[model samples]
Target: MAKSASSVDWLNRVFGDSKYSDLTIECGESTWHVHRVVICAQSPFFDKACSNGFKETSSKLIKLEDDDPTIVREMLRYLYTGDYLEQTKEGEEGSRRSALSTNVHIHTIADKYDIPALGDVAISKFSARAAREWKTEAFAGAIEEMYTSANENKEPMHKAAVAIAAENAKTLLNDDCGQAFRKIAEAVPKFAAELSIEIVNMKEKMPPTFARYRCPNSMRCNKVNMLEGLGQASGSRTCTYCSNQYYVNVWVSKKLDD
Candidate 1:
């Protein structure tokens, strides 16, 4: 009878670390959990994202507090049972050490748990410090590493590299990247010159369009019209009557030039 009861208990424990914990996560896709927290949702971290997606909601968390039973219990709840991590701010902790420890430990655990949003925030925070001191190589290497770990969103990686290139390229014009830009510019000098000129003038100079608007008689008629009819005898253009000419539509160029 005891063996049968034991067999029933084993059947009742359907496997997996099924823990009942409630928490709120603040990063990545922004999700709220009630009874159960599913794993492997979208993440904000894998990309070169600025915001790290993580925090604790069961009162404030202690820094590096993963060692604390309160923090560690929650961390394990997520790790073992595939639950979402808590997201809390700094002021929520009772002490500086606890708060800092909670963040450090929880964030480390988040990276291990594959919570990209939290990881991204951690990296971005760290990378910002590195980038401020002209750390191009470090930033570049970081971007390369981030690219592989990123999910569907690829904008962050491009943005990071482009931002670095834009700033670095200005003073780095003598470098390889600058040399490459120069080569591309050299390949299309006429195009570059055309782009450099006045926009309207360039349009007027096209093959099928009239380049100039000239007057036939500058002495007698103050008004001028040349494009009405040029070749045939009947192809004459009428002139506009200014304040001096009155309402008369004078046939200014009825005569063909030999």
Candidate 2:
């Protein structure tokens, strides 16, 4: 038999020696427990703007489904107190889970839970660390922050996050998401050119087979306009209804777009 990540005595405990201290919340929804709780609400502005037939997501309490749900709990733990570093350590197992790395993971969970205050703390704390940590678990959280801002980023918090993402790109550059990375890099032109160079180098090292990406979105795939004089089988593709060029990549050999 193998021991799951859970099942360990410490798995049931909080990141540190923190307890299920009594807590209260009042807003859209209120949910708290011995270990953790969740609170969320739909944006009223969105609802009112297109009110022809809009409804709000009712407030509801949510709990962890994972047996060893330390990741989420720890983030919530930080949300309760801006001082994750100062949280009192727990018994025998306390030594096992003490590290700046754990705090980084908690930051990710906090971002997932829409806890901005906790996320700011995570970013501020992790910003000073070296590159190794950013490329690992921290990368995902940074990307999440970018995506969140893309939708609607307006505040001092977003400004700080944008700053960190740009600064870290020089060390954290990866080719897989070059487009997204470029967008983030442009935000901080202080070293944009150098950062872009690193991104290009990493992209160049990737295998050619990785070039073609499957379109995963639900939108319908259609002909792309093969650029003029490009000489693709799609015959310099053009479409009046949807696009100006045929999806050149999808066109058959020997024929031009359109």
Residue-wise lDDT of candidate 2 within 129-176, one digit each (tens)? 423344444444454443343323233333443455455665446555
* Model 1 lDDT per residue over 1-258, tens place: 022556445423422323442433333322223222222233222121212443432332213322343444444344333332343555643233322223334445455445645435443543354346323334433333334332344344334334443455444345653454344334545322432343345445544422122344557754444343332224334444432322212332333342
- The TM-score that candidate 1 achieves is 0.25
Estimated TM-score per prediction? Answer: 0.25, 0.30
Candidate 2 lDDT score relative to the true structure = 0.41
CA lDDT of each prediction against the hidden true structure = 0.37, 0.41
- Over 4 Å off, model 2: 1-62, 66-68, 86-100, 131-258
* Backbone clash count, each prediction separately: 26, 14
Which candidate leads in TM-score?
Answer: 2
